[model samples]
Target: MTTSNWLLPEHLSDILPAEARRIEELRRAMLDLYRNCGFELVAPPLVEYTDSLFVGNSQDLKLQTNKLVDQLSGRTMGVRADMTSQVARIDAHLLNREGVARLCYCGSVLHARPSGLLADRELLQIGAEIYGYSGYEADLQIIQLALDSLALAGVQNTSLDLNHPGVSRALIEAAGLQEQAGEVLSLLKEKDVPGLRQLFEATTGVPDDIAAALIRLPSLYGDGNVLTEAASALPDLPGIRAALQALRTLVDALDATSVGIDLADVKGYDYHSGVSFAIFGRGWPDAIVRGGRYDNAGSSFGRARAATGFSLDLRKVSAGLAPAEPSRAVRAPWNSDPALGEKVRQLRQDGNVVVQFFPGTTQSIDEFVFDRELVSDNGQWVLKSTN
Candidate 1:
């Protein structure tokens, strides 16, 4: 036999029955929530042309997606890492309409990025997309869905970290530290305040003031009042200021207590032209839900419209919650006969689990498998319990 190691990298994992079933319940509950909000659900393929996949989300996902060549066409494709791009493409080409189309999706997604850079390469994302909608009302609807899902998942100690990408980009560029700011942000993302300050001090030739501002950015996280601090310190950075104002509006839109601020908490994508954020709760520093506005992503196709959505990572959500008890996977058809089926339904309605087998289908339900001699003169189905 060939030798192979059984160890798996931290990047990959398998969900045993107990965990998988819990995740399934969360997914179903999320979908039900989406449906109640009037959003229709659709599922896209796990694989799509690499060109098509990258076009909507952007070039960043290139290395993260697992690329392959389709057997029939031989054209290169990649296992989809996100569902947003595909949904955007569909809206552009298929809807071809003039009004907003609310679409939701749920599916398993694959990526090459390890769990550290993200939660897992193999992930499940369930969220909604609204096409042809640019107004803030659409934003409200999606946000409500996200809030509702968090409750359904039983997530606690949760805090909503909000930031406006538009403002962050504008601020960075305005400060004239666009390039180095990325590195500074990276250090801060790891919560490496010491490294961040050291990097700021070492990067000579950049003004000390800018370096100081960049270093100060990390500690700027917290509350509606934090905006005033960023505003005062980075007075010349209008890009950052405007971004904060938009954030201020979004925060004001919601009850101030419901959301929190993190001026330094940036997202992975530069395409988040407007507000961007991820949900974090106890046991999950990685986002349980992530979303932002992509106003120009669709322009790569043939249309331009603002869009934003957040997906609930059911796996991580379930991981953080208590392990639900295991349950049977397959259930018996009510019964072979119409009358028996009715009785089984009533039992199920009363929360009793029961399985029924058709009379002719190989001994009605595998109640037992044995030689014909096992049957007694008076026929009956019976088996000795393991107990």
Candidate 2:
């Protein structure tokens, strides 16, 4: 006996109509936001050659993409786990002649389910990537644009925690524990401060200075005060100093009170050779949007292009919007004379959701029939209730 009538894979989720509408509205708003900023939107197929997945920034993403052999060629292809890599591939191969490309994408990206609803494998992702720019100004602009996109989605109180992957990479190499990079990063990603400390203790040939710096990375978050503290704390490490200066420069450029930089925060895509950032807001488990400079993501396509962009989880943004409903309080014409029936019928032709109640005939979303002058010409649009 088949006990299960049907089952959906654990990671998949459905977007209902109202929720889907909200998401679509957000997508339009965000795309328009980017389009206004000179970013041209492009989309890639859901599946592609396995190499396309690996030749980008995400090391873990390649393994997570859904894969199967193609029917005609008998070659393996994987569903993209992220859009950043795909867009980069397209830019390098298709738009290579162009000096730079500002690209955006909105669609579903598949990943192996991560044992949670929030990290569902089958998910809707709306994101963008800016490629072939050497300037960090491009990075700053994209991050700011991401914040704007979130604001456009009606997301409030978003915290933009900034970090430099190059800083962390330098710290790892400084500690002479480059092999421990993955373990240390895992700790940082989990916000496991104690775990990171233990990793530091486990590391051999570590300078006391670098060990201290590595241990402090996870807990560093706040306002401008956080950056000041980091400035004093990491005065000697070249990587940390460069990161601080970069952040200071970014801060000087930004004129908004809503944006803040967390100096001690370290997070990013692995190929973010320089700076990285994430955007957090209400209704999102972690950051609702994130992206960074993945210059090397284009190398797999045989071109070296610097890139930067950010994206919001469209489905999550959709989750926050209130649903809309059809109104049933439409007004219908009222009359005391029997000859007024024609007038009522004519009013119905205006498509005003008119309701005319006569024996065996009710015309409209709401009901409207008999009423005294006191209630009849109340000068309101809503129909009077007979009951």
Candidate 3:
């Protein structure tokens, strides 16, 4: 590659100072919010053994993970494309707590490929997980936390895309199309209605009623009324009915945030066995937050804990939101006076950013606005407003 092209790899770039500060501020605010919600923070490693990293119902992560050989061990290690599986390992093998464990994490994850057309190949993921709870209660808590997190980041006009894989899985199984279920699921997830109709027409032994419901899955997205419509349109199987009921309860509970149902919204259907949701905000073409219930995610690590959580890319979420005000700095002159040095120390102690000007070098205060400049007034240093 040429020198110019060597600056950054495709889909990856440096986060300059201004944006970096914004991201850091949001990260602190988000972690603090998680702490306030009784979620203890945990920092998992950036890379781990491929086997442990891709544990349990994580085929998607397996594909997205970038593998490398560890020099000392000569064993394959994978850069984590997601943190949930690692967190689950912590809960199952490391923590090993008896009752419910509420844990949260924030860190960067590397993906082998970009998630979307404009998505970043590297992302800073911030999320929380609840282990040992299987009911809608845990789902509701995580969903609410996701909304609150977005609000903290200054996101408005947000909508939640609620879904359940069980609803479609049940119908697919009932139709005896389990053999081609994977192909059908891919089509459903893409919302390729015309392609679905063609696929069903070509396939044999699918029941008429089941085929109709399968075709309807793509269109079953909208407001809360979509839930009622789904209940009426889809089969009365236990899984389908139970999924709809759970969604209805969630919708009712979410008073502040708007809710939409996508029966075929199977983004993580292979992984999440229960209620799954994606959060969207105004002007963002993709989900700002995505999370769901994955009860069997930790089975490979020794125990299967009912898990539900949400994760958002801090970079993407902060991109749509407003940047926070820059901290004001007090410009201090480089001097040998003890009292002047003490004044600078006191200003920094009081939570002000103090930028000192060197005696010999040329420095411009215009580079960044220094709200106040320290000047000697009759042998006593005092701050004079630049304004």
Using all chains and alpha carbons, the TM-scores for the candidates as numbered come to: 0.81, 0.80, 0.95
Best by TM-score: 3
- lDDT against the true structure, per candidate, is 0.70, 0.70, 0.89
Arrange candidates, best TM-score first: 3, 1, 2
Which residue segments of model 1 deviate by more than 4 Å? Answer: 1-10, 56-60, 175-182, 191-208, 327-342, 345-352, 356-387
Best by lDDT: 3
- Please give the clash total of every predicted structure, in order: 2, 0, 0
Model 3, span 1-387: residue lDDT tens: 548855788899787666788899899999999999999999999999998998765567888999999998999999999999999999999999998999999999999999899899999999999999887889999999999999998899988889998998898889887777778889998999899899888988888888899999999999899988988898889999888988888888887247888888878867888899999999788899999999968888999899999999999987776654566788888989999999999988998888988887867443356889999999999999988
lDDT of 1 by residue, 1-387 (tens): 854587676677888756876888888888888888888888778898987788653545776788889999999999998888888877776676687778899888887876575467777888887777766666666776787798888887767778776544654565466677657557756667789667756655666666667667678888788878878876466567668777787777876776877767776545677777777778776778877667756776788867877776677678778767644312343334555456556656876545544445644322222221211134432222222
Question: Per-residue lDDT tens digits of candidate 2, residues 1-387?
Answer: 655645667757676555665677778888898889888888899998887777744657765777899998998999887777788888988888566678888998888656245666666788777777778788888888888887787778787767777667777888877666777777766778788778767666888887887777665666556667877765367777787777667766775365566544555536677667778886667767777777777788888888887766687666655553433433444555554555555555875444444545645431223331113454433344554
72: Cα error in model 1, Å: 2.5
- Model 2 has a clash total of 0
What lDDT is reached at residue 37 by model 2?
Answer: 86
Worst 10 residues of 3 by lDDT: 360-369
- Worst-scoring 10-residue span by lDDT in model 1: 367-376
- Indicate the residue-level lDDT of 351 in model 1: 63
